[model samples]
Target: MRYFGGLVHAIGSFARDRSGNFAVLFGMVASVLALGVGFAVNVSQLYNAKSSLQGVVDAAVTSTARDLTTGVIKEADANKSVQAFLDANSRAGILSADQIVLDKLTVDRTANTVQADVHVDLGLYFPIFSVGDMKRVAASTTAVYSDKTIEVAMMLDVTGSMAANWWAKTDKIGDLRTAASGAVEDLLDNNLDPKNPRVRVAIVPYAEAVNTGGLASTVFVEARYGSNVPPPIDAPVSVSLTLAPDKCATERKDKDGYADYSPDGPNTPRLDNDGKTYLAKVNRDDHMKTCPKPELIPLTADKQKLLDTITDFRADGVTAGGIAAQWGYYMLSPSWRSAIADAALGAGPANFDKKKVAKVAILMTDGQFNTAFAGGRGAPRSQNAGQKSRSNAEGICSNMKRDGIEIFTIGFDLDDPSMTMTERDQAKSVLKNCSTADTSSLKHYYEAATGTELAAAFDEITENIEKLAIQR
Candidate 1:
């Protein structure tokens, strides 16, 4: 009886001891806490990886859509393009490129959508209830895109200053050719359709005046050689009476001088000079020859024609930005449709329909506008020339914006050391004021200081225009 009691008492004492229970309980709690912490870390990692993956997929699909719309890649290559982009950007978060899998890619031309689905198998730090050691995070993205018809007019400056190099260390004329030509090629690439064209570009190269080409005789009022014979009403006094060559036309004296009226509506005034104008005094070889060499190429899809025309552009005469602006407007204005038709150019300057078409203008200059026209002759050869020209350009810009024409302005090397601070500021300000206000990532104003930057500016503008065409 005593032995039995002693054995029972010892067992009871063992059960009552709290020291052993504490260890066991602590072991259980530590295991649970470690698992909870591990699971939380895995969840955070998974969330981050998923978010990163989603961003990559979104960018890939959007880029693919843009390329498809721009004809940079065909429908057949879209999947490949997206895959390449994904592969390149897969290492975004804690995820490696090797872990990402492109599960599906769909390019629906009928729907104008590019869709991509991707997944990443992320190794977990700890396995949780009802979950494996790895988590499969998936992401899907789609971009909708379509092309719209666009009309663009580029107003290029061929003023004498373009022949001189500024801070850019390269001749502006040479750079203009490269930049403008490249832009044309990019803009018209696979864009021209015989049945339904999507893009048309007009080149308005301006100096002292715009070369009207075949329309000059029809639009220009004849002025007999030698000046002082009743200069057109409001015409400035001539230092020399010189005549615009056969294909050149100056400002209009009629009610439509600053207006975007058709050439048929009002005849442009005559510019007659005979070595008595300020141009004659300047002593520059081409100063006496007032007309720019590059004629206005109306809205056309002929890329090669445009390339050739600008390639032959020569820097001469003074900056006549106001006249050039007016011509740029005419190139897109429906009112001047007949003039373009009469010139044997294919039908263009389509009637304004904001919903169906986008009209855009790009005006580029390297120096201040120092020339203007009254009647048919140059504006008074004084400081008023610069002010008048800038005012006229801005006025035309306002009118264009009101008419739904989007304007972009580029000031090339305006910070040239040769120009006064005031002059540079005025030139820059004119361009800034002329441009359509910036919106989103599209900047309507650009100041390119070098030839490379100049080319880039053109490329950027083309890209933005392309984006506008392909709205997402």
Candidate 2:
């Protein structure tokens, strides 16, 4: 009895003592500290997971929206497209694909938007306090998509140098054909609503001059200045003015050349053959002329016609980039719609409004712009063709850009060992200065060293165009 009572008394005393109070308080504080640390850790993990999920979802939504806009997939297939994209890229981030659960996908046709909501049950590494073992991390993204009309004028170079030598067992022109054809196909294929096409492409192949083809008589100012053919019935020929042939069109004399004036305003001047200005009408199919065999095809949604035209492209004459750029502008210029009425679509190039339509010009070249007409005199194959062509091209491009035309320029084989430093620089300068500056991933200027790079560049440009069409 005495021993048991003494033990009870000692236990009571120890329990009532305040000497161990500090240790007890320390244990409680330590537990709270551990819980706070765990909570912070879990919160950090969830934040990271949420951020990663949002990125992936944004990308998936944007891609799916593009697919919908391009008519690559229908409304019914949008969910699948988004899910597939999520699956492919989900693992690319911090979270695995399996962790992500696509909660819902909404395709609002009226709004032309694709919105995706996704969530992930992230297993907590440290479950502290009253919180559960897992937390839900969710993300939702919306991308606006629309089939805004797109008009692209591709200014391709068919200069003699493009066919000069073989690289990678194929000449530059051959490579150009392949690259250009592929780009056209990519742009026009599976065109949403063929009858009311969303995209139209125009090919403007040029060398020493742009072959006006059937429209030559309408747009070209024929030779006539007391030195040759008679002037137009309405307009009198200037006595001081030299004359040019009616085969191919060259740069205009004054500001009208750089300006995107209608054929009704001031007509384009004809190209002069060699040093001799045209005194009278010459054979339209004269092989001695600097005009390329391939004529400019205005904006059309017909994919086959475009492909055929590109396939038949032949390299000839010297580079006349300024004249070609001018024609490219004309193709997209709404004022010149009547001039190209027969060749282009019923609507022609859509009004130069970025909101209603996207007008893009793709200027490509393999060498320097060495050919130009001095007044009405032809200056073909000039070793020192000054900055005339480049300056004119830049001026025309500036006008196009001011009118909301997005320009993309490509320089193929500019790094060729055979080219002189001056030649390469001049060729690259015009292309560089012509392209529009872009804030996105796609650049407006591309330097393609080989055919493969050329194809890749075109592909990238096509992607840029598609993205450009999609807003928000």
lDDT of each: 0.76, 0.76
lDDT for each residue of candidate 2 in 371-453, tens digit (9 for 90 to 100): 65532223333424446677668877888999988999999989888789988998888888899986757689999998999
Model 2 Cα shift for residue 99 (angstroms) = 11
In candidate 2, how many Å is residue 126 off?
A: 12
Task: Please give the TM-score that candidate 1 achieves against the real structure.
Answer: 0.70
- Residue 206 deviation, candidate 2, in Å? 0.6
**Clashing residue pairs in candidate 2 (N, C-alpha, C atoms within 3 angstroms):** none
Cα error, candidate 1, residue 417 (Å): 5.8
Residue pairs in clash, model 1: 239-276, 239-277, 240-276, 240-277, 241-273, 241-274, 242-272, 242-273, 242-274, 243-273
